[model samples]
Target: MRIKALALAATSALLLTACSDSPSDTDIQAALQPRLEGASCVTAAMFKSFPVTLGSTFSTGVSSGNAPAFDALTDAGLLAKSDKTYSLTDPGRAAYVEQASGFCYSQGYEIAKIKDISPNTGPMGAAVDKSWIVTVDIRQKPIAAWAKTPAIEKLARNPENLSDVPKTYHVTVGRVKGEQGLKLIDPRFSIMRGVSVSQGY
Candidate 1:
C-alpha cells in the first residue's frame, strides 16, 4: 500500500510538471504577431527636422540637395510652400515627431516567420525562470500614401537598389512564464537600423 501511494504521488507530480510546460513556438508567435503588427515603422529621412522656419527659404534648387523629396512632400499637402520657404501643414504636424526628428510612414510590421527559440540562460548557464529568447523575421507593412511617391520612397530606402523597404528585419523577443501562464515580454524592435535621420540633418 505504501509503494502504491508513492507511485500515485510521483505520477501526479509528473502531470503537474507537464501542465506547467512553457508555451510552444506556435503559441508565442500567435501572441507576438499582434504586438509586432502594432509597432510603427518610420523613415530615416523625410521631415528630417520639425518646426520648419515659417518664413525661411526652403530652396528647391539643386543646392538644397533634398529638393526632390521636399517637392514631393509639398505636393502631398504635408508641406505648405510660400514661394521657396516651407512649413508643416496640419497633416504634416500630425505625422511629425519633434523628438525623433522624422515622421512615421509605415503602419507597422508583420511577422514573416519564427526563426528560433532558445532558453534564456543566466551567467551560471541555468535557465532563467522559464524565459526564452525568440528570434523572428518581421517585414514592414505598406507605408502611408504620402510616403509612396517616388521621391519619398527613394529617400526612405536604405540601399537605393533595394526594391522593398525594410523587407525583413530579424528581431529578438522575450518570453517568460508569469502568473497568467506564459507571456511575451520585451521585444528589441530598435534593432532596426537606418530608420532615423541624423539630428544634424
Candidate 2:
C-alpha cells in the first residue's frame, strides 16, 4: 500500500511539472506576431524633414549630396520643386512624422526564429519576477511600395546612407509570466538611417 501511494504521488508531481513547463515556441511566436505586424521601420535620415525656403534653392548638406533621391521624391509626387526649392506635397505631409521629423516608410517585420529563452535571475539566482530573456531573429516582411523605388533601393544599398534597410536583426525580447500566461514585454526593434559623415554623400 505504501509503495502504491508513493508511486501515485510521484506520477502526480511529474504531471504538475509538465503542466508548469515554460511556454512553447509557437505560443511565444504568436505573442510576437501582432506586435511585429503592427510595427513599421523607416529610413533613419533620408526622408527627414528640413526647413524649406520657397523659391530659393533647397540647399542643405542632405539635399545637395542626395539630389537624385530628392528628384525621385519629386517624381513620386511626394515633393514639389519650384524655382529649385523643394516642399512636401499633400502625400508627403501625410507620410511625415512630426516626432521623428521624417517621412515614414512603414515596413513589416516577422520573427524568423526564437534562438533562446533563459530565465532572468536576480543576484541570488532566483527568477526575477518570473521573466525570461528571449533571443529572436527578426526579419523584414515584403518591401513596401515606396521603398521599392529604384532610387530608394539604391540609397538603401549604400550602407552609409540607409542603415535601416530590411535585414535580419538579432534581438533580445522580454517575456513575463502573468495571470494570462506568458506576455511579451520590451521588444524594442527598429530599422534606422545610418549616420553619414557628409549627410547623404
Candidate 3:
C-alpha cells in the first residue's frame, strides 16, 4: 500500500567500507536493490534464531530458522556444536563476537550491527510455518540526498529539518508471505507519503 524502505535506495557508509574497491554509483545501487525489495524479510530473518542446529554450533549468530545464515561458516569449521551448546572452534571470544556481528539477508542489506535477536512467530512464518523477529540497526543513507536521488526525500528521515547525512535506522524486519517479502516497518516514514522537504522543510 505504501512505498517502503526497500522501495527506496540504500548504501550507507558502512557498506562502502566493506570493500577496498570503489564501486561505481551503479554498482552501489545495484547492490542495494535486493535489500530494498526484501528489506523486511531479511530483517525478520536476521532476528530469527539461527536454527537450533546452527545456534548450538555458534555461541552467537542470527538468521531465520528457515534460512541458512551460516552455512558457509559451518563449512569453514568456524563453528561447531557439542551437545546443545554451540561454540566457536576458533580461539578468542572477541573473534567469535566479531564474526557473530556479521550477517546478511538474501537481499543486499548488510547487518551492520545487531542489537538483539529473538525467536518468535512472525509474518515470515505465515507461509513457512516458522519465523523469527529481529531488531537490527540497518545502515542506510542518513537522507535520500546522499544517494543522489532526492525524489524520495519523503521516505528519508531528517531530524531538525537539516542537512542529509549518514544515519543508522533501527528497524524490525519480517514478512507475512505475500507476493513481495520482507517489508520494512519503520515509524520514521509513516508520513512520507504526504510530506517532503521540497514542500517546505
Candidate 4:
C-alpha cells in the first residue's frame, strides 16, 4: 500500500512538471505576430533601431564618440551604401547576428534563422518614422545550460519582442527618406541618419 501511494504521487508530480514548462511555439508566435505593426521600410535597416531608445532620440548635446564606429559598420557591409548614402541592409542584420552570437554563445544561444519580415510606418510623433521588423529564431547550444543573465533577462522582458512567450528578439530597423537615390528612402542608420527622425514622426 505504501509503495502504491508513492508511485501515484510521483506520477502526479511528473504531470505537473510538464505543464509548467516554457511556452509552446504557437503561443510565442501568437504573442509576437501582433506587435509587428509599424511603418514599412525598404530593407531591414530601418527597424534596426526601430524602438528608438530615448538615449539615441533625446540628447543633451553630448557626443558619445560612436559615430566612427557606425561608419566602420557601413564600411564593413553591415549597412547598405548607394551613391554615397548609407542605410541598413540585410547584411547589416547578418553582421549584428554575428555580433550578438558572440555574446549569446556564452549563454548557450546561437543564431538559428530569421522567419518573417514585417515593414511599417510610425505614428506622427513616433521617434522612428519608418521601420522594418524581423523575427529571428534562436536556439540554445546543445549540451550547455543557458543560465539567464541580466542581458538575457532584459531581452526576455521586451514586450515588443515576445513578452517572455518566445525566446528570440523581435527586432526593428529605423529608416528615413533619401536625398539622392532611385530608392525614395534609405534606412537612416548613420550620422546623417536623422532626417526622418527630425521630421517629428
- Compute each candidate's TM-score over C-alphas: 0.51, 0.51, 0.24, 0.22
lDDT of 2 at 79: 76
Give the per-residue lDDT digits (tens) of candidate 1, residues 1-201: 999999999999997775556456667766566665542434434455643433213532123544555566677667887654678898788776665555656555666666666665633222225665666665666656665556555555453221234344333334433444355555454434324332222
Residue pair clashes in candidate 1 = none
Give the CA lDDT, 0 to 100, for residue 92 in model 2.
Answer: 74
Preferred candidate (TM-score higher): 1 or 3: 1
For candidate 2, list the clashing residue pairs, or say none.
44-193
Deviation in Å, model 4, residue 104 alpha carbon: 11
Task: For candidate 2, give the lDDT of residue 162.
Answer: 34
lDDT of candidates 1 onward, in order: 0.54, 0.55, 0.33, 0.35
Q: Ten residues in a row with the worst lDDT in model 2? A: 191-200
Per-residue C-alpha lDDT of model 3 across residues 93-142, encoded as one tens digit per residue: 22232323322212223434445434454454345432334444444323
Clashes of each: 0, 1, 7, 14
Candidate 2 per-residue lDDT, tens place, 71-111, comes to 66667566788755678888777766766645555545666
| Cα TM-score of candidate 1 | 0.51
Per lDDT, the best of the predicted structures is 2
**Cα-lDDT of candidate 1:** 0.54
